[model samples]
Target: MEDKKKILLVDDEESITRTLKLFLDRRGGFEVRTENRGSQAVRVARDFRPDLIVLDVVMPDSDGGAIAQDLGEDPELQSIPIIFLTAIIKEQEIGGHGKAIGGGVHTYLAKPVEPDVLISHIQERLGV
Candidate 1:
């Protein structure tokens, strides 16, 4: 049997993290870990070593961009892909390719995104 992929979800909203973690857990094929505090994201990621990270842009304690920067700077964590989930921009702003921000290097999904769409993105990013 193949090993399940690891995913880290970083969001300030407890409900959002909980809901997403439940949904992904129920779906199977992946092991998910969530961090509600952005300030603790890097620490958790270092310990969990997830293959992918689903991050939120705005958080009261820490900025997602800063976290991403920190991850990118870390040699151990730099290879992991990140998908930004944000309400700051509408779905239309993402364009057809869903690579609106980060100069086409990163994936950004608008808030209120469908579960299937999120799953598809996750699979596509992970090549699963």
Candidate 2:
């Protein structure tokens, strides 16, 4: 059997992480791990070694940008792709389109994202 794609989801909201983890695991053909505390994301990612990361932009502990920077600086983790799921910016603000921000190191999706859209984005980024 082929190895499954690995994904790490970091969100302060336990509900969000739970929902996404369940959805991705059942339907996306991927191994999913989730961390509810933003501060712990890097450590968890280091251990999980996911092929991609789904992050929340604003969290009480640490913002997604800082986490992404930390991951980027790590040679072992730098190649992983990060997609930011956020409500910090309104849907219309980015032309109502999920845009690839941060020079493709990150992609931004509005909060209340549809599961299918999120999975599609992940697949596209992972080239699956």
Candidate 3:
């Protein structure tokens, strides 16, 4: 039997996290855990050991990019793929260290993301 895929989803907004978690848990075919603080993301990711992390780039405490950088720097969590969810990106221009989507993100999904699209991206990135 295959192992169940675990996904850690972080967003500062309670409503967004709650709604996303419900849809993700119901149909996303993975164990999804939602965290509402960016500062705690690394700790949760370290403990949860999720195969993928759905990160929000605009949290008030700590931006997702900083969390991503920390996760990338940590050997235990570096291999986990990160997908940035945000509303800050209103343009299509790409720029970053690797220069993709205007910053350091594996993929960017704009705010008000549909449940199906979110699940699809999770499946695609996580190979679930």
lDDT of each: 0.84, 0.86, 0.79
Overlapping backbone residue pairs in candidate 1 total 0
Off by over 4 Å in 2: 95-104
Candidate 2, lDDT over the whole model: 0.86
In model 3, the number of clashes is: 2
- Stretches > 4 Å off in candidate 3: 91-105
Q: Per-residue lDDT tens digits of candidate 1, residues 1-128?
A: 88889999999998999999898888846799999999999999999999899999899999888888888788898878888899898878875134433222567888887877888888988888
TM-score for all models, in order of appearance: 0.91, 0.90, 0.87
> In TM-score terms, which candidate is top?
1
Model 3 Cα displacement at 91 (Å)?
7.1
Assess candidate 1 and give its lDDT: 0.84
Candidate 3, residues 1-128, lDDT tens digits: the string is: 77779989999999988888888788876788999988999999989999999989899999977888888788888888777888876424422111333233487777666778778877888776
Candidate 1 local Cα displacement, residue 62, angstroms? 0.6
Off by over 4 Å in 1: 96-104
lDDT of 2 by residue, 3-68 (tens): 999999999999999988999999998999999899999999989899999999999999998888
Give the range of the ten consecutive residues with the poorest summed lDDT in model 1. 95-104
Instruction: Name the 10 consecutive residues with the lowest summed lDDT in model 3.
Output: 94-103
